[model samples]
Target: MNPKVRNLSTEVLSDNWYILRKVTFEWQKKNGEWQKQSREAYDRGNGATILLYNNTSKTVILTRQFRIPTYVNGNESGMLIEACAGLLDKDNPEDCIKRETEEETGYHINQVHKVFEAYMSPGSVTEILYFFVAEYTKDQKVTEGGGVTDEEDIDVLELDFSKAMKMAQNGEIKDGKTIMLLQYAQINQLIKYN
Candidate 1:
C-alpha cells in the first residue's frame, strides 16, 4: 500500500502449474494525474539455492538438468548447469535449501551461510530466491543424490572452483543464480585459488 497507488485488483489467468495472474492498478503520477495499467505476473512461490564448496580442495558442487523453458528459448541442448535449488513448498529458506542440497547433490550439510536474497525476475515473476553457501566434506555425502521425484532427473557435478568460474566466464554456465553464487564465492574468497 503506497500513497501513489490506488484501485488495485488481480485476476487469475491460469493455475495449471502454479499460478498466473493479471493485475490491474491505478497509479498517481508525479504530475498529480492518475494512470491505469495492467500486467501479467507468474507466482511459483519463493525458492532457495545453495553452493557447496570445499575450501581445502578448492572445489564446488553443481547440478545439471534439462529445463524446458531454456530449451524453447533457443538453448540448443536444453540442459542447464546450476547450483542446487528448489522451490520452498512448505519450509523456510534455510531448511528448504538444506533439503534441496541433499536431495540434489547427496551432501547432507549441517550449516549454511546465507549470503543474500533477491528476486531473480522481478518483471513478471513473483519469486524471491534465497542464496546460500556451505562448506562440504567427503564425509557429508549420504546418498547418490539425483532428486527424490520421478520428474527430476539431475546430474551432480564436482568441479574445481577455478574451472567453474571459467565456465561462467565463457558462457557455459548461463544460469543467473549459479553465476551469482560463483561470483560470490570468488569475491568472498571462499576458496583461495592461484
Candidate 2:
C-alpha cells in the first residue's frame, strides 16, 4: 500500500531450502518519475534470539557451531560463536525463542524480556529477527544441550560477562545478533563488570 510503489510482481527463483524470489516493481522517485527496478530477496522466515545472562555468576551462555555460509565467505573454521536462536516455525516469537533456548542451551527458562526487533539483512534477505534477554541460574541447566537435530552440532559455552564482551570486541564472536545482545546487556547494566 505504499503510494510510491506500484505494479509489483514476484517470481519464485528457488524453493529448495527456503523461498527466493525476484521482485519487480515501479517506484515513483521524489522527482515524480516512475522507475522500474528488480531485486532478489531470500525468504527464510523470521527468527528469534536470546541472550542468557547470570547476574549472580557474572556469566553468559553462548553457542558455537559450524555455519556453511560463513565457511564459504572466508571464515577459516566456519565455526561461529552465537546466541541461541531459531526460526519461528508457526509459533509466536516468545514461545519459539524459549524452545530454541532449551534445545540449544539446555536451560528451561520461563521468563524472558523482549528487547527489540530488527532486520538483520534487508537488501537480499527478508528476515525480521526478534531480540530477547533472560536471566539464568545454575539450577536451570537441565541437559547438556548440543542441539536436537543431526544437522545441528552446537557447543554451549558459559563465560564471564566481561570475557564475552571482549570476545565480541576482538571478533571472536562475529554473529551480529550475539554482539547486539551483549551490547544491550552492557548498555542496560544487566551485569556488573569488575
Candidate 3:
C-alpha cells in the first residue's frame, strides 16, 4: 500500500473456494487532487506450472483438459493443451510444481529448474504463477497419469519439441502458461536432443 493510495472500503463478493472482492479507493494525484475509484478483484490464490522435457528424445510432455471458462468463451470443446500446473494450496512453489507434474503427467521428476514467475491476469486476478522446467526420463513415470481421479480426465501428450513450438506458433496451443514455457525453452536453449 502506497501513501498516495488510500483504501477507502472493501466488500467481499464471494468466498467459496477462493475470494472475490470489490475495493473502493482514493488516489492522491501528483497534481494534489483526490481521485476515487472502484475495482473488483478475483483471488484464486497463487499457482505453479512446469514443463517436462526429454532431452534424449527431444520431446515435451503436456496435458489437455476441458476448461469450463474457455468453453463458455467460444472454445468449441474447451479442451486446452497446457503444461502441468496446479494451485499452491499450502506448499512451496517447487513442491507444488513437482506434485502437479506427477499427478497431471505421471512423471515423478526430481530435479527441476525454476525459470521465472509472472502474474497471468494481474488486471483482475490476484494470482502469481511460478514457472518451472524439468528433464524427464522413461524410468521416472510411475502411473498412467490422466490426472489423479476420474474427474480430472486429463489427456497427456508427448510431442516433439519442435512440433510443440510450431503448434504454439500456429494457433494450436492456446494456453498462455504453456506458450510462455515453450517459448522459454526456445529462447533459453534449455532442451537438447539427439
Candidate 4:
C-alpha cells in the first residue's frame, strides 16, 4: 500500500556549517483517518565517509578527537575514534569521500570500494551517509589532519586490523559510523581475521 502524505511543512531549526530543518507531515490511516507527526532533521546532502585500510600493512586509519556531546553525556575522555567523514558540499559522493579521506588522513586513495549507504539517524536526522573502503600503503604521506579552527583538535590514529577490532569489541571505539565500517570490512573479508 502507498503511504498517504498530507499537511507537510518544514521549518528552519539551525543553520551553521550544516543546516537543520524541522519537517512535519500527516498521513491517512487505513480507516481513512488523518494522523499527524513531526520530525526535526538536518541535511548535509548525501555525504560520503570512508574506512581507509592499508591491506598490505593491515592498518586502518582512524581519527581521535574530543566530542563535546560525548563529554556532556558522561564520557570521561570524550575522545572518539571515527572513520574519516565529511559533509558533501556541491560535490559528488565519490569526490567527497576521496577529499575527506585526504583531508583527514592525507592518503590519496587510488581505488575506493563502495560499501553501502546508511542513515546515521533516520528517526531524527536526515543524514544519509555513504560508506566506502580504500586501500593504501605505508609509503603514503600524512599531513596534519585536524579540522578548521572552529572544529579543530583531531588526532590521526593508525591501528592494525586486529587491534581495531578488539577496541570495537571492548567498547573503546563507540562511534556508530566507525563501528559500522569496521563490521562491514570484517564481514566482507576486507580485513583479515585471525
Please report how far candidate 2 places residue 183 from its true position, in Å.
0.2
In the order shown, what is each candidate's alpha-carbon RMSD?
0.8, 0.8, 1.3, 2.2
The runs of at least 3 residues in candidate 3 whose Cα sits more than 4 Å from the true structure, single-residue gaps closed, are: none
- Which portions of model 2 miss their true places by more than 4 Å? none
Per-residue lDDT tens digits for candidate 3, residues 20-122, read 9998999999999999999899999899999998888989999999999999999999999999999999999999998888899889988899999999998
Give a tens-digit lDDT track for model 1, residues 100-145.
Answer: 9999999999999999999999999999999999999999999999
Per-model TM-score, in order, reads 0.98, 0.98, 0.95, 0.89
The digit string of per-residue lDDT tens for model 2 on 120-189 reads 9999999999999999998998999999999999999999999999999999999999999999999999
Model 1 lowest lDDT segment of ten: 185-194
lDDT (tens digit, per residue) of candidate 4 on 1-194: 44699778899988886778888999898899999988888776677888888777788999888888899998998889999888888888888888787777777776788878988888876778988998878666566666655766778889998899999999999999999999988888886655
The lDDT of model 2 is 0.97
Give the local distance difference test score of model 3: 0.92
Candidate 1 wrong stretches, greater than 4 Å: none
